[model samples]
Target: MKQQSEMILIGGGLIGLSLAVELKLRGATVTVLSRNQQEAAGLVAAGMLAPQAEQIPSGPMLDLCLRSRALYNDWTRKLEEMTGLETGYWPCGILAPVYERPDCTTLPQTPETPSYWLERDAILHQQPGLGNDVVGGWWFPQDAQVDNRRGLIKTLQTAAQELGVTIIEGITVEKIVTSPDQKVTEVQTNQGIFRADHYILTTGAWSGELLSIPVYPRKGQMLSVRVPDDFKSLPLQQVLFGSNIYIVPRRDGLIVIGATSEPVGFTTGLTPQGVETLLSDAIRLYPILKEFPIQEFWWGFRPETPDLFPILGPSSWDNLTLAVGHYRNGILLAPVTAQLIANWVLNAQTDPLLHHFRSDRFQTLR
Candidate 1:
């Protein structure tokens, strides 16, 4: 009989909790240490699972996102089956509206999910409420969204707990204690020192604080609005990806509008300019949004690398893995990240998909 691997996962965000659930399902005893689970970026995200809509050039990052998007249907279904919770996994698709002439040069179209240009009348018929400047747009039928705050985050937490993954909240990991042989022996936290057979860092934006990784916080401010019950028409059925803004509508009349990409370091609070700009751009994209009442105001820090890609696979230290710096795609990439990390930890199998996202990729650039 084989012994179960004892794993300690630092960070209890969506990425950490998802990975913890995966590790537990793979016969590993997992414990997750979360600093502040409520403040996790996943909780604050608008949960747009957009690859083509994001206009990512054809590359490894785009490939990673599309692969994760492919796994979402099965992944969310399994989680709901196990925990009996809905993750708000809506394959509602996305419409990238253009104020000027439509151009498909920047958008990468995959054979599995090809995006096509929609004429002005066609787009208006599909989604009626649009600003007057809107002409035509590209339709990404495969792009989808999840209600991260209201659905997926809570569902993932429930799934992890139901699967017997020990999650310790409010405990901050101060440092990673390594030995002379470059193996993580234990983690030094505010509470005390804890040891595990393996350690995985999914700390998101704070990854650089504990290790020499290039992960840093990229701040984003977002807000949500809800349509009034007496509104004349139905709420938006699909996500609208406009210039520097996205409008994601939920089944329950809650529309999420975001965001601003500020390189500010861990700065908290929503600025007046940030909110103003979001509302200005959002209203211009969807004219009816101005009538919706503001529901919430918040912000979060995305873990970003210099190359704007994730740092996955093993780190320099033995028995320690890197799964941080997901930037804007943490919610979308959670399933694939969990699966790949679990495979490497339990079976020692490294998927070729992880080849471009290794922890040492930044070192080569230096």
Candidate 2:
């Protein structure tokens, strides 16, 4: 008989949903179980799709990012075609202003790209309210973003429904029960029994509670302020880069300012200090943002790995796969992750990305 076709995935966030979409497209039956809280986080994240603009220096992490960036165009197209969701994916560009002298240190100008290193006059012309004090900056027209909140939820719910993939809500996965041979036989859930041939854990920050994968919660605080309709220029067309913090604008006039990367041990609270820091920094970068009224103040935890990249592929166990600890790049890396995992589920040996991120790295941990 052919290999069993049912693939059960835990965590209904972008990663889980994207994987379901990929697998369903390839004719595999997929089921996604998402706890309410995990589903909500996807409804709140800022979906930045910039790898070159967001990659931090050098490492295996940067390589994963660049590869993911290359895959996004094709991935988004399929999702849009299948689900008919726009996904708000824009590859327009990113603007990194250099107002403070330290701004250059954070997001350095790429001399290779002449369009970067924008003069103050040009920045003002391109973005009218860019704090006239700015001197120069970098511009990346290829970096992109999506309205992550809408894109994720719509994709998950719609894709699952349209593609005949099952989505069970309010089902919190307890653990992956493995056999003596290191094969996952079943997933224990708060609701009931779920048996599967292959189990994937993509629970983000919560993955640590279920699996000892070295994934931790890195607290990130965000501010959503509602800008006035009559406000001067499009305060944000590109994901704005700045000295300390950055801003992302949505179609509904809600601009997001973020974030503080605090390892607060899974505490997702709304803090005054966090709010002040994001708001204050946003104004420093774009004086026009100061004119907006504050709307939402909140914080959440990002699933962080020591290597700052997701661990994919089969777990130490035979049938359990790990897909957590994406840290800051979860949204950016979702498309490629889905493709890689979907391939792993089918081919079992052809996924090079799987071998690259396996937990065997922990054996060399020092």
Candidate 3:
């Protein structure tokens, strides 16, 4: 029998864990090295699968987000079956409401997109929890969400481990050693040196520290609150988005409100201003938030790129691949990314989407 290829993945975040599971299912021996499994932004994210709502001015990212959103249903379902864990996959759609009329001016009008401009009466009829401040809203019926804490962090970890993928927590890769021909050979880590035939860098924000890449930390602060007993069953059935804040309702009677995007590098402090902004905006959208008890407050660094799009696919090194720089949409894009990276490693097939997210796309700009 031919020996299974050895794959060492650097970074145990959502992307890394998903890739590990995908590669392992393809019969490769995969191992994941992470600094600390608890610190990834994927855990802190609100897990909103809003593709049209998070659309950039214009780019391939929206298309990519939509593609991943389509795969989420099957992906989470399979993960649940494999690990027997509830991933908190909620297909309850998203509502992007604006307090002022100007906020609705930039809503996209793509022919194939399933968004509708909702008037005040229609918005209130659909969701009665809104405050009078909401003038209008954009409804994306296809967008969905998952509980990152349970669905992604715990679920992905459980699924990866069940698939025979070794997860080394609290380990750091100091350097990646490649052969003279630019093929990855081994990684020197805090624990020891580990060799593998293939290396995947899914280190997200800290990706630049290990590889020569442009990934940076975009800090985001978020908070969660417990829904009152009366609202526990339904507690805002859909995700509500305002100017800079978004409100996500979990199935377990907890509502997640977030987040402030600060360009401060790698700093993980929750500022008074950040918390104040999130609560104030959240309460503005739904007055009932003031009656709820605070659940949690935290922050995480989003792995961002210059173009605000993710970098996926192989790097210059033949045996190394780059799956970092997912930014705000990492949770939404994880499944598709895992599939593409695994396909490339197992069959050397390049998905068309990889062209838009190549690691070296910015070489011509310099």
Candidate 4:
């Protein structure tokens, strides 16, 4: 019998934990080193799996997102079955409201899931609580969301652990010890040295700290609110994409409002200005939001690359794989990212999907 491939994954965010689950299910001995789960961006994400609503242009990034969005249903279902925890996979669709008449040509409409423009009256009927400023909107029926904070992140962690994936939290990775032959021999962490046959860097936002990758932190501030018990249903039934903010309604009466994308490096804490801006914008998009009580205020760092695409596939080291720089789509892209990376690790099959996201794309820029 062939010996199982031993893999050590750095980072235990949604991306890391998802990949760990995939690898372990494929019969690999997987160990994940998580610096801090609370600091992980996944825990703080709004978990909007919106490819069309995000208006990503037709390209590799869009393709990657669409593929991952397609995989979310089965992925979350299997995780739910395995862990008996609901991931809050709500395929309630997304509504991108606009104040002015939107130019149809500029819209990112794909054949897989076409977005239709809803006139003022039609949009108002869809969402009665929408602010008067919303003249019209594009309705992406296929776009959906998951509850990251309350559902997906915890479910993924549980599923990973249940599948025999060893997760060691609070251990910060100090460095990757590589052999002279350009292969990772072991990883040096605050806990100790851990050797593995292969290593994966899923360290979002901090990928550059460990290696020469272009991944960096893009800080975002977000908050959630709870609907009053008197309401018959959620004030907002669908995810509302406003000009500068988005309002996501949860099944459990908690509504998520977010975010401000500041290129502030690793700087933490939610600013008063950030919270104010989000609240004002959210209220403008959905006037009824003013009645909701603020539940939480938080922020997280998105692992962003220079070109705004993920840095995936093999690194310069033979045994090291790069799977960072997911930016705002970390939760949306977790399923597909795990599948692609696991295939490469277990079968050495490099799918053509990884062509655009290769780590070598930044070689010239570096």
Candidate 5:
């Protein structure tokens, strides 16, 4: 019998955990190392699978987003089956209210997602909670969301555990050791040295520390507010996208409001200005939000690349593969990224899309 390929995954975020499960399902022996699972931004994301709502014009990133959004249904279903847990995968769609006519300009459209302009009356009829200040807006029926913090992570971690994938938490990988031939052979961590046949990096913002990648932290401050009992109407049933902020409603009566994009470089702190801007923008989208009590305030650093696109597939090192630099779309792109990486590792074949996300792109540009 052929020996199972042993793979070491650095970073147990949604991407790393999901990749571990995928590799295990493909008959590989996988071990995942996470410095701090709770610190992962994946747990804090509002989980908007809005390829059309957050369109990337026309490029490889758009292709990746749409493909991953298409897989959420099946992915969540399989996860639910394996873990018997609800992933809170909601296909309730997204509503982008146009507070001003200029906000509607350059509204994105995609062939796969069904999007249309809703008139002012139609907008109110669809989601009656919005403020009268809103005019018309774009509605994306194909867009969906999940509860990443509580729902998605629970299912993923449970599923991975049940699949016999080993996950070691609170273990920080200090550096990756490569052979003289430029092939990754082992990883040195705070806990100990671990050797594996293959090494996969999904360390998000910390990717630069392990490897000389251009990945950096793009800090985002977010808050969640609980729905009040005296509210006149039901909680928001769809995501609200306004000028520069978005309000995502949870099934459990909490609205997730976010975020401010600041390049603060690994620094952590919630600023008053950030929170105020979020509240101001959210209230402008729906005046009723003022009645809700603030439930949580937190921040996460998104792994950003120079081009703002993910660095996927093989890296410059022979046995090292990259699955980082997803920025704001990490949660949205987790499923397909896992599938593609697992497929490439198992088959040893190059995927055509790998060309677009190669980690050596910056070096080539130099």
Candidate 6:
């Protein structure tokens, strides 16, 4: 029997696996438990690190996203060297396209906030495939994406093994057994008993359901389609947004159309309504995409907290940590979350944002 662990991470998803790798690199003996065939939320994401584009105007989420965006280049390079996997990390930047409705009673806009405003003629010039009545947009040069599917799998499974971190899959953790001091002692699984000195949960949408996190699942159904042979003639130069819809194009000739946020807990299957909404809006935004053939269809859950941000940092337990509830931003935030968790573990300091996402925030709502 293993006596005790330097650390044990749960959920084998992006955050769990990334943190495990970081900890092991820092000399901690780490083990990651990944269970089920569930695509492990991060795997299904378009992996856009677009804080500047998705900026919520005001909140801790904006700051967290910016901090994470700042880390992408270095993080992707490190993962690539170790696993020889192309993370497809493109720093080509993102464009936040704006649509205007000709409102008669509206305040003047602020240009310093990084948004672009153009009339139909200019929009047609910039994006030849756009529909009529197009307005201008915002540009986020820092927003980028990783081929999250490849990145998560290679980073967690392949890179983790290369770094000597143990991965146990398909085993459900029944309970977290702890010492009298209330530190995480081990996790009991259906397969067997695995002991550890500390535990971190990165279970995504399953985080709250597993351990009463103030979290829930927000499902997004997305699809990928191949662009036309002449895709390059009027190809999208940046990630695009029209109204509430977003179209993300990859270098591999795959243009991804996504995604509607629905509150259906833990259900992976896509509904007719979900698919209709996404496809309809996608075609409306980029008329060229309508001619492309559909390549893949996917549905995933974003682990959302009440405040729509991740609940990270120390738990009430001496050695337990909360690194879940990242909701839609998990893929964007994974690397930075791993780095921050590693820093907290090494320095024993609590993140200031912990006050906002702490489990206690929900008791008041109840």
- What is the number of backbone collisions in each predicted candidate, taken in the order shown? 0, 0, 0, 0, 0, 4
Distance (Å) between predicted and true CA of 177, model 2? Answer: 1.1
Error of 6 at 273 (Å): 1.6
Comparing 1 and 6 on TM-score, the stronger one: 1
Query: In candidate 3, how many Å is residue 56 off?
Result: 3.7
Candidate 4: C-alpha lDDT: 0.89
Q: Write the per-residue lDDT of candidate 6 for residues 1-366, one digit (tens) a residue.
A: 343566778888888887888888789899888886356677567777777677565567776777777788888788888888787888767665555645532223334234454456665776677765456555555578777775555755677899999888897888877668768777787878787667888888877766766778788888888867864553876777667678887787777777788887777788899888988887777776778899888887878887776888877677888899888888888877888888887777666755666666667678
Clashing pairs in 3: none
Q: lDDT per residue, candidate 4, 1-366, as tens digits?
A: 112238889999989999999999999999898998776779767889998999888888998999999999999999999999999999999999999985662565658798888899999999887888888999999999999998998899899888888898898889888888999887777787888888999999999999988888888999999999998976778899889899999999999999888888989898989989999999999998898889999898988889999988999999899899998899999999999999998899998989899988878666
Which of candidates 5 and 6 is the stronger one according to lDDT? 5
lDDT on C-alpha atoms for all candidate structures: 0.89, 0.74, 0.86, 0.89, 0.86, 0.75
Please identify model 5 stretches exceeding 4 Å from their true place. Answer: 1-5, 102-111, 230-233
Q: After superposition, how far is residue 61 of candidate 6 from its true place, in Å?
A: 1.9
Candidate 4, poorest ten consecutive residues by summed lDDT: 1-10
Any runs in candidate 4 off by more than 4 Å, and if so which? 1-5, 105-111
Clash count for candidate 5 is 0
Poorest 10 consecutive residues of model 5 by lDDT?
Answer: 101-110
> What's the TM-score of each model vs. the native?
0.96, 0.89, 0.95, 0.96, 0.94, 0.90
Measured with C-alpha atoms, the lDDT of residue 168 in candidate 5 is 88
Candidate 3, backbone clash total: 0
Candidate 3: segments with Cα more than 4 A from true spot: 1-5, 102-112
Residue 225: error of model 1 in Å?
0.7
**lDDT, residue 171, model 1:** 89
> In order, what is each prediction's RMSD in angstroms?
2.7, 3.5, 2.7, 2.6, 2.8, 3.0
Model 3 agreement with the true structure over 219-272: per-residue lDDT tens digits: 889999987777537668899977899999997788999988889997778999
